[model samples]
Every structure is written in structure tokens, then in C-alpha cells.
Target chain A: MSKYTLREAMAIHASRQIRNEDKVIVGTGMPLVAAIIAKNCHAKDAVMLMEAGPFDSNPLALPSCVADPRGFVGAPWVADPVQMMGMILQQGRIDLGFLGGAQVDKYGNLNSTCLGTYKNANVRLPGSGGASDIGAMAKRNLIIIAHEARRLVEKVDYLTTPGWMLHPYENGKRVKDRLVHRKELGLWGGPEAVVTTMGIMKFEEETKVMYVSEYYADLGVTLEMIKENTGFAIDTSKADQVIPPTEDELYILRNVADPENIFI
Target chain B: MVSESKNSTKKTKIKTLQEAISQIPDGATILFGGWTVTRKPMAAVFEIIRQGKKDLHLVSNPGGPESDLLIGAGLVGISETNFIGHEVLGIPYCFRRAFEKGGLEKTGYLHDDWTVQTGALRILAGAMGIPFIPTKSLKGTEIIDPEHDLLADLRGKSKKLPNKKVEFIQDPFWDEGELLLIPAIKPDYCIIHVPMVGEEGTVRIHGGLFMDFYGALAAKKTIVTTEQITSEDYLKKQPDLNSIPAEFISDIVEVPYGGHPTAVQGMYDLDFEFFNRMVDSTKKEDTYVQWLQEWIKDLPDHDAYLEKLGVKKIFSLRADPGLGYNPRLKRKS
Candidate 1:
């Protein structure tokens, strides 16, 4: 297998999180790319929901946005945004939600609201569209973000989406604990994985603090590089080198999922 | 109860696009109907720019060309947006530029459930004459956080409006539960482009009804532009197809290819090349002004705008009847 772009690797890694029966609520860009790839390959029966109110849409081409005209093609049920989010999502019917953020903390908390202050931001990002809802309610959520020191911060400026609120330190080392559940906060679900350009990261089941799971070895991305780019201390003790994308996966993604190579 | 007038007494007010849009007073709160580049009321938005309307407050859930053009023209004062982007084409360059430059004032909410859905719920509440609607999505997020002053700052800048931007309350019945309540929004006017509008004011929207259905109801008045304005009898044949009732609409204009640059599902495809050009032109300040001069200022009206787009480009975007999208359009992988 040859080397792949980080975007392609991220999409491929993100697709691995989808299961055959998972009802996925997808956002735009790479999440759509990853979902299409998963649908065409492993998670063929996965129910996909678009925020613009379509269920089980089978478009010939990838939809550019949630409400892209293509999303309406051969859709099983077309609903209003309220019905999709308020009725379906808020009801906790969605199983998986794929989201992205401008910044993510060690606890997997996301910040897409603003850079400095909400009112006066040094760099005002496009705020969470449905990320908060998805992050708060999807039974399991996957986040896709580029690897950078500032992006993977120790603490986010604002908690746009709840990650793990309980981060207790013992002897300056994180302890294994689940202090607050989404259910406790009147929200459901939480971050499951963080797929980045370099590798995949997951939270310690008990601690809910993110740790490197698999580093992409084929791309020559080292654990040291990952640590250097991360704002917080990341545990790579049990991390393994990820196998490169198989030829079959690359062929399917390039030819079928992202024929436009929009994300790749 | 006074018996509602049932006769053809319901007037189908017809106005030129300019005249219809001129009714939107300066600084009036407005809402636009469309998602992304599809079905955006480009012709009417262009008219607003040409008329030099100023200090307008736009409430678009997930906006596109309409809001972008308004901000670019400096006509908008405050904008409540969830996602102001061109989708695959990328974020709205002018909007981002204006926003970052402080040339535009803005507030955003979560799109997944809070932003667009909340907007829809707000509109539904407004249509039903409700004070506010309870939502569970914005809770546990910064949107409901009192410390977040993104919206509060803008509220201070604007004139005294009737409704509070957002409010939080502990659920009276539930022991440990709370909810976010967004006040109902009734826009002074809402302009939307549709595939067809009946001569009697019925609107037939192709593809997903999206927020257009609610936006029409949530506004005090609705102005509709369509690819074709068929006879009232034609629309009456298929009552199920009618999305917006005649009574809610104030005026209807027949404007072919009015959703150009954007799309009119089953009629044409999004002009990707045009979007690319807009993105490129808006990358720099001087070039954006030049692009605007060529497209908006120079072109007198919708006809002129279409004429400037040229027959070849327009024909290329035309969707095949069976496919509902341009068959000739190709995306490079």
C-alpha cells in the first residue's frame, strides 16, 4: 500500500467507527465522505440522517451539504429540520454522530464557538451547527480534526459541547474515573474517538480522557510528533502502529465515496 | 367568530421584484428561505442590494447567497446565522471576511439541532401566535451560557426589540432538568424562491420543503419568485403538492432562472464555476468590489443578470427532466 493524504487517512479511520446497524447523524465535508465510504463498504445498512430532514437518502453523487439537492434523491422520508433534530435526535434515537471542531481538549471537550471570548474573539470560528446536539445526544460520537498543538488544547476556551466534565488528577497523573455521565447532565452520549490526520485517539473508558490508540506508521508520523503537536500530555504507552489503508479501501473511497476527491 | 372570507376575494398582489422588496423597511428584521445554494432568492436579494437598503437584521438559520450578498452590499446590520456557507464550494467568503473585519455584526447557534431546528420551532411558535417554545438542545452548551456575550453585545448595539434573544429556565415538573427557550420570531417579510407559484399565490416547492415552509408562515408577508406561475386551476388539481397557502403570500413574480448561481432543483444545477469565481474574487477586498461591480452594480435586474451569465453557461446548468440535476455536470475526483 502507498502513502495517503492525512485527510484521506482521517476519513478512512473515521469510517472504521461506523457499524452495520448504527443510525448515523452526519455533518458536512469529511464526515459525509467517511459515511459514504462506510455505507459503500462495511456499514451498508447503517441509517444515515441529514440535519436538513432526510432519512436514508441514496444520492448518486456525494451531497455537498446537509440540504444539498442531491440528498433529496430517492429519500425514504423527507422531514423538516425540527422533526429531524427535535423529534428524532433529541429523543435519543440516533446511534452515531460524526462531528468536527475548531478545538478539542484532553477530556475531548470541543470548542467551535470562538477563539478568545464569545463577544470579542481574536478569531471567531463558525459556531457549532448541530455539533452540540450531536455531541450531547448521539449514543456514540466521533470527532475528526487536524492534528496541531493549539487545536488539541489542554482546555478549550468555551465548552461548546460537553466531553468528560470529571477530570481528576492523582499524583499529577489522570485517574481512571467517569465522574459525570451525559445522562446526569440531561444530555446523552459523548465523544468516542478522535480521528486526526496522524492517528486515532480514544478516551480511557473510565477516565474519559483522550489517549493515542493507534499511530499511522506508514505515514512516518511518530508518537513524538503526535505528542509535540498536542497541547496536553497524551498517553501513548499502549499505542500501536496503524496498518495502512488497504488497496480495496482506497479504490472504493477514491472511485465511489469521493469521486470528486473533495476531501482527499 | 367572523366567517373567514372564502371567495376569490383573496387578492393575488403582483409586484416587480424591486417594488416587492422595497416594502422591507430599513432596519426591519427579515428572514430568508433556503438551504445552502439551492432555492435561494438571489434575484430578490440582488434587488435589495441595488435599492441600497441598510441596517437590516437578517435571521437565516443556515444561510447562503442571500445573506452573503446582503452583507457584501453593506445592507445588513445584524445577522443571526447558524451556518453561512456555500457548502462544497466552501464558507461564505464575503461573510467571513466581513465578520472577521468587524464590518458585519453576527451571532451563531448550533446547527445539528439548535440553530436551524430552533429557528423552525420559533417560526412554528410565531405562526401559532405563541410567546416561546421550549427546546432541550441548546442546554449544556455555551449558547445558553449567560457568560457567552456574542449575542448580548449585538443586542445592545441594535434597537430595542420586542423579544429576548434566549432565556433559560429550570423545568418546573422535572426535578433536575432545564430547557432553553428561544423567543418566537415573526419577520416583517420573508422572500423565497420556489420551482412554481400558482397565479393565486400557492407555492409548489420541489425537493425538500426545508425551512421555506415554516419561513413563509413565520413572516408577516411573503414574496415569492418562481420559474413558472401556472394558473390557479393547474395548482388546484394537485392540492398535496401545495406547500404555502395563497393567503400567506402577498406577491408573486414569475422570474425564470431566478435561482441562478444557486439552483432550482429539477431545473438547474449549482453553478460551481460561478461559486469558484465568487470565492476567488472575494479573497481580496478590491477584487470583491470589482466582482460585485460586474455582477450586481452593472447588471440592472434579474434579466440583465441572467443575460450576463450568458446562454451557454445557463444552458450548461439546466438539469435534465429525468435526473433532477445537470447530467452534463461533472466533478473531478
Candidate 2:
């Protein structure tokens, strides 16, 4: 196992979420690093798609931005956003999606809009770019964000992106025996994992509530720390130590994927 | 299909940037081409603001400085966009200020996955001379729910928005899947910046075509500003590079460094320092006004704007043709 920065470990963990030949929809920056690492390591043929409208892009270098020219370097088909999102993603062709959010809730709801109410905002973050669509439409979503109490809240200030929904009965049961997927609300599956700097979170099968599934042993994290840092109650029964990234995985990320450490 | 094989003769006339933009009047709806922080026709945007055009409805897949500057200047009456934020720099301060101050009106839904694609489909429908097109994007989302008045109703009622936001119905063919019918959007004028344009008005867009071709075709008229203007014969040799044929375009203007602060592929990198400075100043209304005075009002035209940018700074932003990014920005990590 390779010793790595928290960010690098997060990237590795996020990469592990992807599977071989998965039709992955990706956001920018860290997701880009993770996807590239996945392609280099195990999921070699994972079809990388960007919301900016490129498919099967074999970029010469890590794209500086979502709209970066590197995306078109060896891309097979360059399409419009309509073709990318409407015809492909909204058509339910995507297998996995990688996203980032400012704040996420126990129900996996995401907030990238204003911090306060819509009419009055203390701090207005950038609203959803393509997160709402990816979250609402992709088969499964994997969220990567810095772990902090402020970010992992009990309930997001605004539900910019829907996750596991609040069906009335689920709230009463304290466990979602009647847990509804986003598809029940006529959307796609909600988030499956929340990869953080400290650990990886997965939704409980029955309740659809998030809990720490894997803790970073190298970070010296404890179940108490995860609980204290989280705004809501968390399930630690299924939690276990996550295996660190292999040296080869670390080398590919550092030397090939991101030599500048721009995202790593 | 017939339009593609016509005479192949250039029909649109070339004009100065001023003369070309002078055609746009107040209350006109304009669609812009380019995505966030890349290939935006900032030169045309600055000119529109400098000309003091008002109440103009603007449309883009999702624009950056071009939309934010116009909204901040209080020139745009309504803007239909997917998302408007400085990509890595966070939300644009001016855009937020415009909405917070009630200076600009906004329509359309959030997220590029729907908004840009829907906007492009609207453009495509217009290009095909259709009234509306059916789409599968907005079935589950609230934007098409009709209950969401902001997105569904639009600003009161006007000829500008003649059709409903979306009409949900069962797919008649299969009688199973649900679909939404969206109305077409034909802007009065469309403005875009390209890497190069032949003398005959064939636009060669380097990098990604973020619905620029659709935006150009979907509008009543299109004005192109390019980094370089080459001969028709030069473009004829390589027909694949010609994304926008001359027939759809109305006017072509050669404006070097037309997409400043943003970027033009193979020409320059994004002026991060300049955008950062603008963001810092535009954090508050007072300083934002000051920034406008220095960057917009004080400058006579795009030429003066370039002059204000200085030769050294412009040169520093220039990217090597081979590398696609400025070599000056080397970070040893």
C-alpha cells in the first residue's frame, strides 16, 4: 500500500467506485482525476463522458476545465449538450456518475445553490451546473467532497439535487421500510456512496440513510470522530477499515494522471 | 439538405464590428455562442454594453463574463441560461448582484444537462422552421412541472415567449414512455466568437462547439467575430474545419483577441488574473461599478479595451500553437 495525501486517497477511493466498461458521466477536476485513474488502473475501457459534450475522449493531458481543448484531442464524437445530456444521459444510458457538492444531507440530498433561503442568501454558491441532471438521471451517483460538519449536514439548506426522497412513512419509521428511490419520484437512482477525505459513506439498503461504510485507517479516524463530525446520526455497524491504494495506483495518479498535482 | 448543396457562394457581407452590432436594437433577443470561460465573444458583449443597448433578451447555453457583464451593466432585460458561473472561480459576483438588485430577469432551468441541451434543441427546432420539438429531459424535473411558475410561466406574457415551457404527454408511438414538448426559440440576433473565419464567412471553431452552430442557425441573423480571418480558398482546402457554412451567417468581423479573459483555442489561455481581479472588485456593488468604469465605460471600443489590457499582458496570455496552453504558467509541484 502506498502512503498518500488525503486528497490522493480520496481520489483512489472514488476511482474504486467505478467498474469496468461502465458508462461514466463525469464532472470536472477531482472527478476527472478519479476517472482517469480508473481508466489507467482497472476500468481500462470505461467510457468517459463529459457534460461539455465529448464522448470517449482520450485527452492528451488532464483537461484544465470541463470546456478545455484537451477534451477534443482524440475524442471520437464531439456533440452538443443536448445530444450529451438529453439524448444520452436523460435517456437513461449512463451507468455511473461522479459529482461534487457544497453540502449533502443524511438522505444524500445535495445543495450547490444559495446557503440561506432562495430570496435571501448569506452566501450564494454556484447553482447546479449539471449535477441535478446527473443526480436525477444516472443509474448511480458517487459524490466526493471534503468531510466536515458544515458540508455533511443533517439536511441541506436547499435540495438543489434530489437523492433518497422523504416519503412520509419513512420519516415516521425512523427506518425507511418504505424507502423510495428517486425513480419513485420519477427520477433516477440517488447517490450510492459519499467519498470523503475521512472515509467512504454508503446508503443503508433499507432506510436509504447514509452511514460510514469504510473508514480511512491511515487518517486515524474513529467511529466516534465520524459521528461527532456528522450533523446526523450515522450507522457504524457496517463500517470497516478501507484498504489503502496500491503503490502502482499512486504512481499512475502522480506521474501520469496529474503530474502537477493540480487535482491530486 | 438542399441548403447544404446550394450555390456554395457566400451570401453574407463582411462588416466592421460596430456596423455589425448596430443592427441589434433595444428589446431584441440575442443568442450568444460559447460555454463557460471558453470562446465567448466578449468583444461583442462589451460593445453592446458600451453602445448602451437596453432591455435586450439574451440566450446562451451557459455563458460567463459575456452574460455576467451584460446583466451587471443592466443591459439585459431577460436571460435564459443553463448555468452562469466562473467555472473554477465560483459564482460570478456581477451575475448574483444583478439578480439580488433586481436589475435583470432570469428564465430557464438550472443544470447544463437539461438547459443547454434544451436550448440547443430549441435552436435546432428554429433552424428546422418548426414550432416546437419533443424532448425527454424534463419529465421528472420541476422545471417542466407547470406548477413551477418561474420556469413554466416566464415573464408575464410577450411575443418573445409565445409557447409554453413544456407539455408533458404520453408517447403516442409506444403509448408507454412520457415525453415533454418544448417550444422553439429563434433569437433576433446571434453573436459568437470563433478561432477563424474564411473571407466567405465559413467559421472554423476550434475546440468544443458548445451549441454555437445551433445558436447561429437558430437565430434570425448571426454576427461572427473571429481571432483570424483567412481567405475562402484557404478554408476550401479543408472543408471539415468549416463548422458554420456562410449561408447561415449574416456578418463576419475579424477581431483579434476577441475572446479575452475567456480563451480562444490555440490562440491564448484564460486570463485568470484578470478574471480574479474582476471577481474581487465585483464582490460589492461599489467596487463593481468602479471595475465597470475602468474596464467598460472608460474604454471607447474593443480596440481601446485591448490597449487597456496592455501589450505585455496580452502577450503573456498567448498560448503556443502546439501546446494549447500558455507555457508561462508553469508550476513546479
Each candidate: fraction of true contacts kept?
A: 0.43, 0.28
Query: Please, what are the lDDT tens digits per residue for candidate 2 over residues A1-264?
Result: 556888888999999999998989888778988998999999999988888877887776777667876666677888777778778887889998799988899988887765664444566555666777788778899999988899999878766666786431221122333445655545656799999988999998887899999998876878888888888888889999998889988998998788876676
- Tens digits of per-residue lDDT for model 1, B207-266: 777777777888888899888888777989999988888888888988888887887788
Docking class of 2: acceptable
Which candidate number would show the highest DockQ if scored against the true structure?
1
TM-score of chain B of 2: 0.89
Off by over 4 Å in 1: A166-181, B1-10, B101-114, B150-163, B174-176
Q: Global lDDT of each model?
A: 0.77, 0.77
The residue pairs that clash in candidate 2, if any, are none
Chain A TM-score for predicted structure 2: 0.92
